[model samples]
Target: MSIEHLRARASICALTLISSLTLASGCSDDGGAEESESTDESGESESTDESESTDESESTDETESTDETDTTDGTEETDTGNLSCEPEGDVTISYSIEVGALDEPPSVDLDLACTLAEIDTDGVTQVLILDCPELENVAVIDIAVSPDMSLPLVGGEAISMRYILEGPWWFNTYLRLDVEGTGHLLTLIDGDSLLPPEEFEFTSPVELTAVYDLCEPVSDGCGQRERLALMTTIAGEEAQIFDANYAEVGGEEGTEIWVGAAGHLHEIECTDTPDEWFQVLIVGPGEG
Candidate 1:
């Protein structure tokens, strides 16, 4: 009821109000702290998600590199070089021998082995290249004579043989035979001259036999020296005609020329050994 008492009561009321305001401010500060903590948690979650995304990208890059390596390995498994030729088949060669002229009866037929050797050459050694490896560069020609066959009045018999080289490539080429032990290249043809389609009407061997068989006056013109010269002449004309005879070069005027040609041809290895059997290999240009 006094003035001092009233002042003291008013001071107490002011102190209470100040305390209430301080408590309210403290609560507001606590709420702001909780909000800030929640925001920090959210930031951490986003950082973790970004790290997982980076890991996935690195794994994809490694997988792509592995695929590239597999592709490179596939390309290395295919590469080879040159190829060679091999033998495959064979062919037949037929030979017919007769003791008389065309359309003769009692003829003998012979067959020989021939190979279908396919090869490539520059046209020069086509025959040698096409022949079988066992008989390469060597020609083997044989004749079969039977007891039933008869020798006509004429000296030599008629003989023929056919050997077809397989394939279209051999049609345009030629067949050449190199005489064994003789430096002679003989081409077979069917004419009285050295040309295509090989054939022969008379051979040197037959003529040599005829020189002895058909000689009536063996003591005079058909002596051994004269017969040797005649044989040389026949052999020389197998490739070409020289028109060689005793009548053409018998006297002293032509004796030198005939003797010279005979000497040159006699040097051939074929003339060294004279026999009744004709040469099957040397298919010379004949007097058909």
Candidate 2:
């Protein structure tokens, strides 16, 4: 071939080589840019996932701590017993007595006083106080029939007495009337004198006044029995005789009977049924 033709061919070959190199370089740069973008996207996703996981863990810990605090606070709230009923100040009691079936007005004097002795809450009854003996069982019979005639020993003479206690902080009041000495004769009467001996027998109904700290003594053989009989009334009975322990010997409801202490008839009452009488014993404070 000619020399000019050979030179032109060489030039065309050089230009084609340059063009191919430029295209290969451009394709490599595009691939690198795409890979870098993919790497950045993956790194951002990992960082977001880690942040969410940390927040969840912290939130769970906070919730657990709050729960523990609430439980601890609830355990410190219930400890005081029934001692909340104690009177904040001193209490006083005033009572009057009426002597029934006396020919003339009886001059009866009662110097009653109560002092706080102790606090007892264990047993069938709660809140029991020790009562002073001087203020507990004392029978005062101040009756004057006629200076002219000595009190007669007849069958139809009735003596009735009523007592009352007034106070702002009084809780529960109970009365106990004890009669001693048998030289003069005085017949006992029931709550209401309308019923006959067989119906509402003669049982004296005295108003019970609340005495502060008056707890029944456990040693007094018939004290509990006597208190129960006095609190309960029966119809058509003379006296209520119980054992020294006042545990109830047995009788029908509303029946009048006497409970004796050793040989002393210290309690008298008429009950509708024997069960009622026994119930009082069951609910009374422990004999301390």
Candidate 3:
């Protein structure tokens, strides 16, 4: 069971407390992602296209040449790449933004505006900028947040495209994702459209079997029962939580959870599990 298909190339940044974005725009790899062949369990197909490197340590110091000028802080580095995901604390709420590329067609810079509380949260979280090789395709066009939010966006060539933010009551928008050319494997659609991803596959590390359970008791409703789950086994399917440990989980079994280096595979649940004797271990997301 060697089923790879998890992009996520790192190089994620989105620092925009509330303002400061000056795009210059330009990107082109034409419309990539039309080459696939990754089969290993001994079936042999190999040829995933090869080109993975989002370069994100907090990257800054443009290079790909477009019209180079700024020396470092002189202000004039145009290859067009400015990311902003803000909304972690002091949240006022209300959002609206839409900007497309790759021929370009989705537009709506900001339409709805503030005020809504019942339970609509997840302001913004999906950033990775600076390396916009002029941007051949950078679209998040129509950012509407209010009771409907489900963002994922990670790294270039579309690593984790998961967007669904219905609007109406609070809006603030700005989205541009084109981290250095080669077609951004885009997909963030539910109402307004945007789709691109014909193929993509890459996976190499395998060896799993991790289970842990202790949830159930929010008066039985199990709101998330304290939280402390960590299942595993990706590709073979049926057992994937990756990581979640709110705090006390006693006796820790082996314990070693980093969950990074591009291995994302989330699928957590908590409706009930008072404990029926479950605590198997043997996890790995480390030792890259």
Q: Give each model a TM-score.
A: 0.16, 0.15, 0.20
Model 1 TM: 0.16
lDDT of 2 by residue, 193-260 (tens): 11112321222231111111122223222112112222222232233222212222223422222211
Off by over 4 Å in 3: 1-210, 215-228, 231-287
What is the TM-score ranking, best to worst? 3, 1, 2
Candidate 1 stretches with Cα past 4 Å from truth are 1-209, 212-280, 284-288
Q: Backbone clash tally for model 3? A: 20
Summarize candidate 3's per-residue lDDT along 60-86 as a digit string, tens digits: 122222222111211111121222211
Which 10-residue window in model 1 sums to the lowest lDDT?
16-25
Q: Alpha-carbon error at 69 in model 2, in Å?
A: 75
Compared with the true structure, the alpha-carbon lDDT of candidate 3 equals 0.19
- Span of ten consecutive residues with least summed lDDT in model 3: 37-46
C-alpha lDDT (0 to 100) for residue 75 of candidate 3 = 13
